[model samples]
Target: MSRQIQSRSYLIPIHLDENHWSLLVFNINSKQIINFDSLYNIDKNIAIISNLISILSKYVTVLKGAQNWNFFQNYSAPRQSGDIDCGVFVCQYANEVHSILNMKQFDIICFCETKIEDSYPNSFYKNDYYYKIRLDRSRHGGGLIIFIKNSFVLTKSVHPENTELIYLQFRKSGQLNNFIYTFRAPNLKEQLFLEKLEDFIHSINLNEPLFIVGNLNMDFSDKIKSNISKFADHNDLINFVKTPTSI
Candidate 1:
C-alpha cells in the first residue's frame, strides 16, 4: 500500500514475484505511474494497474479523489533479453529515467549568457593565449573596441583614414600572412567604408587566407556587392556563409 509521499519525489519500486522482477515509477507531484516489464497483455495489464491503484488508495487519499489515477493504457516498455536479465533491465530503466529527470532540472537553472564588467586581468586572461584589446575612445556617441587573442604575434593593421573597419594581422616567426577583419557598417558612411576597404584589400598580399566576419548592414547593391564579389573571386577567397544571420 502507498502512503503520502514527499512533494516532487519520485518513487521507483521493484516488484518481485517468486522468480520474476518488474519496475514501476511513481511521481508524487504529477501522480504519474510508469510500469515496465518484459511481457504484457492488454487485459492482464489493465487488471494489474487497477489492482495497484486500489492498493495505493487503501493507505491514502488524494485531494482530487481516487478516480484520477492514470492507468496509461496501451503501455510499452523495454523488454528483457532472458529470464535472469529482468532485474538488470529494470535497474537500467530506472537509471535512464533519473538521468532524464536530472537533465530537465538542470535545464531550468543553467545560464545562457554572462556579462563581464571588469576591465582586464580576469581569471580567463591567463589561459592558452595572450590578449590585446583596443577600447572605444569616443566621448559619447560611437564607441567600439577590438580583441585579439592567439598564440601568434599580432599587430594593429594599417587602414585608410576615417574608416570604420578594424583589421588585425597574425604573425609568427617574423612573418605576417594571416589576417582578420571586422566592421560595423553605418548607412551614412557606406560609400567611404567601401572605398577604404578596396584600398586596404589592394594594399595586402592576397596569397594567404583571410577571415572577415561582421554585420555589414548593406543589402544587394551593384556598387558594394559587385565590388565585394569581384574582390573575393579575384583573391580566391570563399564566402562559406550564405544564410541571413539576423531577422
Candidate 2:
C-alpha cells in the first residue's frame, strides 16, 4: 500500500510595484526571510534592469509553518535583488532566481483586469498587460493564487471545487460594516477584497510551508489593507512590503 504524502503551504506576497522592487523568500517554518533580493541600481536604466531580470530568474524553496525554524536556518537558497517591468514575482522555486516558475497548475484565482492609465484594461485576449501578473501567458493584468499540488488551503469564504481563491471586493453602503465606516473608514472595494482574501487564507492549516504572491495594492498606513496583513502574518504569513503603498 502507498503511504499518504503530506503537502506544505506558505502565505507569501511578492509586493509588486512600478518603483524600486525586491524579492523576499520567507521561511514558512520561522515566518522570516530565508533569503532576499532587491534592486541594485535604479538610476541606470538598461544595466540595472538587465541585471534585475537575470537575478529574478533564480528559483526558490518553500517551507511550511510547522517546519522547525532551525532546519530552515541550516538550509537556504542564495537570493537575488533587482528591478523588473513591474509585475508579480514568482514565490515558489529552489533558488529564488534563475529557475522555471509556474502559476498555472495551482488552485489559485484572481481578477483579470486592472485600472490602467485611463480605464480598466478590458481586453482579455491580449498577453502583455499593465498589472502585476505571475506569468506572461496570463491576461487579467496581474495577480496569482499559487499553490503546491495537494497542499493545504486557507480561507474563510466558500470556494468552487478544486479552486484556490476567494473574491476581495469593496463594501457597498448597504452592508452591516457601513456603521463601522462612521466610526472609522470603509475600505475600497479592492481593499475589502484583500481582507476577505486574507480571512479565507487563514481559515485553513497546512502540513508544509507555502508561498502566496499577488498584487495586494495595500500599505501599512491604510487601516483596511493593514487588516489583511494582520490576519495572515498573525499565523506567520509573511509579506514582502511594509512601507506605505500606492498605485
Candidate 3:
C-alpha cells in the first residue's frame, strides 16, 4: 500500500556530516533560508515549531526511505513531472549519510551504501578529490544517483513510464555487467549497481533535463568537468551551482 501524495514537488536535502550541526531540509517551496543573529538565551539545538502560516509554507517532513531527499512522494500520482510527462524516479544510498528517509512519495529508492565492497575506488581519487557528487569511500561505493521518467507506462523496467539514467558519468559497457566493470574486483558490486540503474533509464527512451546533485566523493577534474558540460548541453540540462563558500 503506497501512501497518498498531497503536493506537487518538494525540496530534498542531505548533509553528510553526521553531527546535528548540519541540516537536511525538505518541502520548503515558499521560503529560502534565513540567517538569524546570535541569541544569548535561546538554544540553537531546539527544534521549534514555526508559525502556522509558515508551517503551511512547506516546511520539512522527515521521511523513512528516500534517496538523498526524494522521499516526499506522498504528493500525487501517475507520478509525472516536467511538461511532456516522462515520469519521475530518484534513487540513492542514504546509509552513508543517515539512517533512512521514507514516505510513499519516491518511486525507486535503493539503499546501496550498506552493501559490501571487497575493496574501494579510493586509491584512484584521494579522499579530498572534490567532485560535486560525494560517494562514500569507507564502503565500496556502489552508491549512485538515477532518475526515472514516465512511470505510468508498463514495461520490464523498474519505473514503467520513466527513462532512468545514472548520473555517475561512467563511459563503459553499460554499468557493472560490462567487461571492465568486474576488473575493479571489490568495486564490481558498485559497477553492477550502476549497470542496473542504466537499464532503468534506457527503458523509457527518456531525454530530459535532470539535476543530479550530492556529495559524490569524486572530485572535479578538468576533463570530468568538460564531459559533464557536454552531457548537459546534449540533454538540455544546465548545471546550477549553489553560491560559493564565503570567507
- Best TM-score goes to which candidate? 1
lDDT of each: 0.47, 0.33, 0.28
What would the TM-score be for candidate 3 when compared with the true structure?
0.26
What's model 2's overall lDDT? 0.33
lDDT of 2 by residue, 11-86 (tens): 2323333332333344443444332233322234434333333343332233332233331221233333333422
Query: Model 2 Cα displacement at 68 (Å)?
Result: 46
Greater TM-score among 1 and 2 belongs to: 1
Q: Could you estimate the TM-score for every candidate?
A: 0.39, 0.27, 0.26
Q: Which candidate do you rate higher for lDDT, 1 or 2?
A: 1
RMSD values, in order shown = 23.6, 14.8, 17.0
Q: Model 2 compared with the native: what TM-score?
A: 0.27
* Residues 1-247 of candidate 1: C-alpha lDDT, one tens digit per residue: 3245334434333343433445555556667666666654335555655565555555344423333656443146777555555544554555643343333332111100111223423442222333434323222112233334455576555433565455667676777764544454344465566566667776777666566655455543444666456656666677765543322
Clashing pairs in 1: none
Worst 10 residues of 3 by lDDT: 176-185
Candidate 3's residue-wise lDDT over 121-201, tens digit each? 444222221221222322312333222212322122122222222233222233321101111122234435334434543
